[model samples]
Target: MEKLEERFERLERLAEYFIEEMADFKKWVVRFLSEYKREVDRQIREYKEETNKRIEEYRRENNKRWGELANKLGTIVEDIIYPAFRPVIRKYFGCEPEKTFMRLEYINREKGIYEEFDAVAVCQDKAFLLEAKSTPREKHIEEFKEKAKRFLQYFSEFGDKKLILIMASLSFKEDFVKQLSKTNIYAMAYREWEYMDILNFEEVKGA
Candidate 1:
């Protein structure tokens, strides 16, 4: 009877030891799983950030390529400048265009004269002539003025309409805008690189 009791007590101690060992194993498993989950989440976050950055870079590169193609084809005027005409004319002149012409050309064999207009919008009693440049310069302003002087000669039908000249580009410098304000011509460009607008409307109109 004494031997049986001692064996029973030994079995209890062994059982207690096994229970404590199991608890420690469970805790280790939980800690390892938690660390593993955190590592996975961190990896996912880094992957997302890298993917977004690459997508943005690709978008900018694609836009630059398209812009270069447009410039090479001399379609920058049609692409960038033509769309701004109606809104600008209507807003500043308070009249919608009856007809709009793009890339208009005139050749007078008798006078040996040739002229090309980037855009033209004819309203009730007013006409807007637009000249666009990918890269604008001071010489371009003077050249446009000379072209404006001969506009009536080319299109005698528009002679009765009040002529309004406009010069357009992607953007303009402050000095360029100031110089344009001194002239009768209106300047149209991107405002804050967001949308196209007339830059010197009030100054030109008040002049």
Candidate 2:
């Protein structure tokens, strides 16, 4: 009887040692996982911030370049291109096409009003609002609103005058353009130079 009781107590001590070792191993595993998870989270945050910074820098550089190009293109078009077309216009219609230049702001009295239209050619009190894009896209409507609308009402106002809107772009979707045409407005693609087909053009002279 005495020997059996001693063996039982020894077995209990061994079992207790195993339970304590297992508890310590579990704690070590939990600590290791917590540290790894924190490091991974930090790396992900850093990656996101770096990506955003790079994207912003790219936009800044590209926008500067585009502005420069647009200015150059505008000068070239006004100088050489328009002159070439003028002779054609004179031969066909006995008149020249007038290109109006406008910015995104208006000086109304002492106050300033923000506007979207780039320019208009007014012939005989008819207003032809012009929106010029070097290369348009399918998602151009959203982009146009941002650049064109001056954080105010996004409206092109010929203002009770003969209202005509002409859009000049290289890549305009036919279906989307069809919808634009339905709005009692005119959209001009590269194919048709008569974008808005303004009655106010010099073609209607002596009418």
Candidate 3:
């Protein structure tokens, strides 16, 4: 009986040892899993940040390429348009410009902003803000109107001069010309004869 009791006690101790080992194993697994989860989350966050940075870099590069291309194309158009524009204004308006300027860039030092006119022609009691475009769209018309409205703000001295917004283009959409006829703005085309043909000549004369 005594030997049997001793064997039972020994068995109990073995059982307790296994229970303690199982508890320790469970703790180790929990700790390892927690650390692994943390690592995975950290890696995911870093990967997202890197991906965002790369996307931003790609966007900036694309914008830069587009800007350079636009500048080059604009220069070519300006070369053809600037010289012919003044003559058109003279032929139709029946007067020569007192001052003709291209790309009239002005910076308001106080406002820290700048504005540019494609071409500005000032005749007596009249000023024409002419924008030469490879293709003229409706948005160009709206832009010219907005620019003309703000013209007085930039050049307060020209407040007395009538602002005539004109768009000189190589070609115009049919509907665009119709739309221009309805507005105060004028549209002109460079003809095959290399002379300016005012599309809204009659309408302007009537106005």
Please report the candidate that would top lDDT against the real structure: 1
> Which order, best to worst by TM-score?
1, 3, 2
RMSD of each predicted structure: 9.3, 10.7, 9.2
lDDT of model 1 at residue 185?
Answer: 79
Candidate 2's residue-wise lDDT over 19-83, tens digit each? 99989999999999999999999999999999999999999999999999888866643443333
Better of 1 and 3 by lDDT: 1
Q: Which residue pairs does candidate 2 place in steric collision? A: none
lDDT score for residue 93 of model 3: 83
Task: Please give the clash total of every predicted structure, in order.
Answer: 0, 0, 0
Instruction: Give the runs in model 3 whose Cα sits over 4 Å from its true position.
Output: 1-72, 192-194
The TM-score obtained by model 2 is: 0.44
Give the distance in Å from residue 115's predicted Cα in candidate 3 to where it truly belongs: 1.1
Model 1 bad stretches (over 4 Å): 1-73
lDDT per prediction?
Answer: 0.89, 0.53, 0.82
Against the true structure, candidate 2 has what lDDT? 0.53
Tens-digit per-residue lDDT, 84-126, candidate 1? 8898888889999999999889998998977899999999999
| Local accuracy of candidate 3 as per-residue lDDT tens digits, 64-163 | 9989977866884376667777788888888889998889887989989899888888989898888777757678778878888777788887789988
